[model samples]
Target: MTKNKAVFIDRDGVINEVLTKRVKFVNKPNDLFYLDKVPEAIGLLSSADYLIFVVTNQGGVGLGYMTEEQLEKIHKKMKIDLESEGGEIQDIASCIHKPNEGCSCRKPEAGMILKLAEQYKIDIDKSYMIGDRDVDIEAGRKAGCSTIFIGKEDNTVDANFSFPTLYAAANWLKSTSNL
Candidate 1:
């Protein structure tokens, strides 16, 4: 059986405009905003036979800033919006544990990607992980996948590629990869 290649994307900061800085995390469903050309990018990867998964670390739920139900609402909206634009997300894996909880599924820990790799029969070596944070890149490295970092901040991430936005990265992947 051949393993599928995947593109694991970080939800906040990468796909959605997150409330960062002093107050991080979306407090309400309306707080979630889509970044530019997210659906278009997803579509490109999908057309290239890449399974797209949203891998996020939402510690706000565990920190009492938001409830699981609230987060679900936000995710539902995102899915609906993206799907309406002809994009599909294969799955979503989130680690809602607090920063001090010692969870393995958080960014910088490859547990979530590792589990998804087994469940989806994915080849991590052929996979790509795109995120806007250093921790996200670290997780991809730990998961044995090449990474693309999206953001204007200093290049603190150890990614194979760096782009200003997800769309740019997706375009590059489609053009460069045989997949």
Candidate 2:
């Protein structure tokens, strides 16, 4: 089978506003909010024939801060909202294990990416990972995918590109891909 191409995205700071220092999980569906220009950004990427997948580390679930059912509700609502804006998510893979647990599915480990690649038959060489943190870039690099760091500060990772926001990353992808 032909390998698929994908864009792996991080959830918290990349998709929604980051509530730093807050111990809250987006436990409820109503708590989900897209960052400014996020909808349009996602719309642009969706139009480019890229399979959009979210690879997030939600350790709060394992820490007992939130329930799995609650997370499901939030994700369902998120998918609905994004689809309403002409954005589509092919799948969402999450690492619910805590950092101390030494699980392989977390960011910087490339476990989730590897699993997704196997499941979707994805071509890692043609894949891109976009997020707002160094861990995101590290994971992408470990998985042999191009990395795009979306943040004002330099991530210091050998990322393929950097953008101030998801919208900027989307624009870059659109122009670079000529889509």
Candidate 3:
């Protein structure tokens, strides 16, 4: 059987704006404002025929700032919006455990990605993980996928590629023949 190639993306900072001032996390559906060209970026990747999975760490749930139902509602709205804009997500996996919980599914850990890959028969070597933080890259590296960092030049994390925005990364992925 042929394995699928996927892009596992981080939620906050990468898909939506992280409002550090307004709230540390997107506790409500209304608080989930997307970044520029996010829909377009996802659409581009979708058009390229790569499966998309959102792997997020919603620590706010464990911190008592939000409930799982609220997180579901927020994700529902996100999916509706992205679908309306021509992008499709295969699934979303989130680790609601706090940072100190040391959960296997959280970022900086490969559990989430590994589980998704197994469930979907994804080719980790051919897949990619995109995020704005170092932990995301670390997780991707651990999972044996190519990592893409979407942020300012950070010398700390060793990502396969770096871009300033999701759109830029999508463009590169679309143009790349290796995928």
Candidate 4:
């Protein structure tokens, strides 16, 4: 089987709006808010034959701020919304451990990506990871994938490219693919 190329996306701040009020995390489907251009951006990448996946850290779950059931509800809603707009998510993975838990699947670690690669037979070198934080970039780098950092967030390390939004990154990928 040919190895598949994927576009791994960070959940919060990239797909949904980042929540800052609770200090916990997005604990419900009601808290999930899709960005304006997210569906289009994801669709554009999907059209280019990239399998889209989501890799997120939900420390809130481990901290008792959110339940795994709640997280699943939010993901189900997100997938429905994205699919409605002609986008598809092949898989979703979350690291539901706090920083003190020493989990290997969290951002800045390669556990999640490595698991996905093993499960899907993905080509890590050809895949790309897009997110809005330094941890995301670090994870991508550790996973041997190209990285795109979204938003004007302070990512003073390890990102292959930085753009203002996912749309911009998608445009860059689209343009580069034609070359």
Clash total of candidate 2: 0
Q: How many clashing pairs per prediction, in order?
A: 0, 0, 0, 0
lDDT of each: 0.87, 0.85, 0.91, 0.86
After superposition, candidate 4 runs with Cα above 4 Å error: 20-24, 153-155
Q: Between candidates 3 and 4, which one is better according to TM-score?
A: 3
**Model 1 TM-score on a 0 to 1 scale:** 0.92
True lDDT of residue 87, candidate 2: 81
Q: Tell me each candidate's TM-score.
A: 0.92, 0.93, 0.95, 0.93
Give the candidate number with the greatest TM-score: 3
Q: RMSD to native for every prediction? A: 2.1, 1.9, 1.4, 1.9
| Shift in Å, residue 158, candidate 2 | 3.4
* Per-residue C-alpha lDDT of model 1 across residues 1-179, encoded as one tens digit per residue: 99999999999888887675533567677887778998898888887778989999989889998889988888888877776656688888989899879989998899999999999999998999899889899999999999999988565666898999999998888887783
Q: Residue 96, candidate 2: how far off, in angstroms?
A: 0.5
Clash pairs (backbone) in predicted model 1: none
- Candidate 4 to truth, TM: 0.93
Which runs of model 2 end up more than 4 angstroms from their true locations? 20-24
Model 2: lDDT of residue 130 = 96
Q: Write the per-residue lDDT of candidate 2 for residues 30-91, one digit (tens) a residue.
A: 66777778878878888876788999998889999788998898888877777776888999
